[model samples]
Target: MLSETPRTRHRRIKENGRTDPADLHAVLAAGQVAHLGVVVDGHPMVVPTVYGHDHERIFLHGSVASRSLAGRGEVCVTVTVFDGLVLARSVFEHGVNYRSAMIYGVPRAVTDPGDLLYGLRLLTEHAAPGQWDYARRPSKKELAATRLLALPLAEASVKISDGFPDDGDGPDAALGLWAGRLPAVAAWGTPEPDPRLAAGIEPPPHIAGRAGAALHPRRPPPG
Candidate 1:
């Protein structure tokens, strides 16, 4: 089951390096933003952008005129969802409880009209479920102005660290300072309806119901 390649080998904190593909998907799904790293015109650039993914590929969208998005070379995309703060007895022992993924590949530009719209819909829904259905679909001019990139998940790395502070048996434990994890669960807050919306319109149920919902999967699915 190991898909370990030289580029994805876990070197430090090997135990925290995850090999389960499901873990990679979960981290990406839970995260709304990803860092896309690319080299354009012999200069390196890393940009933060929203992303969406299906079983095999990640979809990124931006302005069609964006220079970085036009680059069709090797790129590294990373997504991380922080779960908690590992507060240990000593400064050196402090760490973070998180799940992260790094995907490597040369992204393919999505230009087909139908496929472009499909990918944009998926990306929109990833951050705001039901938004695509609720709002007006993109028009021809809008579609022409957007650029979409699809990166395959064939080569990637996943890592997770979600344990109690590792200071129980260490000398720092004698310091008597508190040592435990301070969990950080992301939750949706009250939705602020757009001021320009029609007076009678209300926040749809799909968006309204997510208020205060936990973003991470606390456990594995049942059989």
Candidate 2:
């Protein structure tokens, strides 16, 4: 576990802050999207974009002309996954169960063709397992039009909240209201065939295998 730094230090809700590197990795991996914050001219802009993470770095993808991909000096990225809802007897005590990570660093733009292709493949595979191999590879023109940014994970912060209502022993407990967690889960719906598909074509195993699979994160309880 890492100690607090000036940027990552936990001042408020110190108990909810986590500094373990593994915890940070879990949160980032579980999220399918991230918000990238950048400065354009004298203004601040944050855009929601899909992301993928390796043990060392996080990759952000978008169009080459995208305003968010101005390739500025510094950037901030955040990823969050909601696990469940914590309903307490009192409205004020109600909270959400979630895991979140914030990364701050100067993102390096990937220009080399090989590296850019690899990063794009990672991004695709992160969202859908076995997708990169099953789908058509990007053409050279498509690759040229896309932009990929890589940010180191060296400076990051992780926070997670997963617990019963904190008001268990408080005055609200006397209200005799229901209090517990309502887990949040996600699953893919049935695959819809393309309108122009050949009549005899069937779904591939890679797509069929995800039927009824749990889309929830593999994260453990709060640290």
Candidate 3:
């Protein structure tokens, strides 16, 4: 179960709030990019970055000089997967179907050589499953120029909206109008080889196999 702190308490739309830890993990795994919110120079800044997560924590990295990766005080990381658009007879009843999670905590900078290398591998593998093994690993000079941070997944807020318009049972139902959902799905496209590649070179099976695969697989509802 996910701990419900003051920051995670849902004041409105309580029904949409999810307390299960699995739900949080699912949302994080399905997303590719996360927005990291932090205070820089006393001003709020939100930076988009790729992230990787284990069962207990998430890893984020960027250039060493990046202000957002300073690993300072409190921070908020959010990941969202847009599912679809819900259309209703009335404008007020229109909504969206999506899965989103917000995590708040203090992140620590990864400094140890072994831990930094491990974290970097995780981040790369998360973004591209087999690419990490296929591509050359980062060198000492490259590693020195990168900054990595890890944040605990202890406190988080998860919200999933997948229902149809509630106006279906209300007066809006009687209106002579078509109302439904326009679903959105993301899929991987064919791989394009680099122009500098040799003529005989081609994408590996692991990369080519995902050409038509869904970016985020649909999960079943809880029992």
With candidate 1 superimposed using the best TM-score fit, by how many Å does residue 49's alpha carbon deviate from the native?
A: 0.7
lDDT of 2: 0.85
The parts of candidate 3 lying over 4 Å away from their true place are 219-223
In model 1, residue pairs whose N, Cα or C atoms come closer than 3 Å (at least 3 residues apart or on different chains), thus clashing, are none
Error in Å for residue 112 of model 3: 1.3
Candidate 2 Cα errors over 4 Å, as ranges: 219-223
C-alpha lDDT of residue 115 in model 2: 81
Every model's TM-score? 0.93, 0.92, 0.96
Clashes of 1: 0
Give one digit per residue, the lDDT tens place, for model 2 in 54-128: 778888999999988878888989998998999999888898999888888899999998888778877988888
Model 2 deviation from the true structure expressed as Cα RMSD, one decimal place = 2.7
Q: Compared with the true structure, what per-residue lDDT tens digits does model 3 show for residues 77-189?
A: 99999999999999999999999999999999999999998888888877778888998999999999999999999999999999888788889899988999998989999
Q: Which ten residues in a row have the lowest lDDT in candidate 3?
A: 214-223
Candidate 1 TM-score to native: 0.93
Best by TM-score: 3
Task: Report the Cα lDDT for candidate 1.
Answer: 0.85
